[model samples]
Target: MIVIYGIKQQLTPIKAELSDVIHQCMQEVLGFPEDKRAHRFIPMEKEDFYYPGGRSEAYTVIEINMMAGRKVETQKKLIYTLFERIEEKIGILPIDIEITIKEQQSYQWGFRGMTGDEVNDLKYKVNV
Candidate 1:
């Protein structure tokens, strides 16, 4: 799953496009399947969203959650791909985007009434 956070006024209009761009990057870098999209957007009001210096109101934070198996090089490629693709396709500059990948042991995730570690029918590989 991917959680995206940004100011409501700036993020509301581009949510779908942003999701598509992010999914494209994920598929390109991590070999994710076309049906594996899970994006959640958190659009906050300006008063509730505080950001670091030098970033504009368009600043966005993307947090990717997944199983801990991908190689470091693969993860880095995904980050770089996201930065490039988001900037090119969504018009959000690299400086305005912050991305973080959070990985956990498969046993820690639960879905389809089963833990991730027990799932044997995944359409995508996680150890890439």
Candidate 2:
């Protein structure tokens, strides 16, 4: 599963399409349907926060936190794919995006009110 949190200004024209674009990117990278994943998008107006070091011109900043039953290489590839898609869709160069991967034990995550082992077994039977 992937959770994406973004902070950007309201004046940016991409606000309307951000969530859709993110969903598409995740689907393409992870090869999974929306129902099997968890995603989060957070938007902030310009005045609500300050970008230090004169970096205010950036229209979007993406932070992705993901948990998957995949190897490191697979995780890296997924992240790269996401970045490529984001750049293509938003017309932004690959500069301000960040991604983090966390591997969790089967008992660590809860989905649909089911804890780690149950969800893992469910997804494994369905996907693996």
Give the best candidate by lDDT: 1
| TM-score, every prediction | 0.99, 0.68
Q: What lDDT tens digits, residue by residue, belong to model 2 across residues 1-81?
A: 444434454424565565667677656666657655455556666666555453335545555544446666666776787
Q: List pairs with backbone clashes in candidate 1.
A: none
| Cα-based lDDT at residue 87, candidate 2 | 72
Worst 10-residue stretch by lDDT in candidate 1?
23-32
Specify the highest-TM-score model's number: 1
lDDT of 1 by residue, 64-126 (tens): 999999999999999999999999998999999999999999999999999999999998999
Candidate 1's displacement at residue 97, Å, is 0.5
The C-alpha stretches of model 1 lying farther than 4 A from their native spots are none
Judge candidate 2 at residue 18 and give its lDDT.
58
Relative to the true structure, candidate 2 reaches a TM of 0.68
What are the per-model C-alpha RMSD values against the true structure?
0.5, 3.6
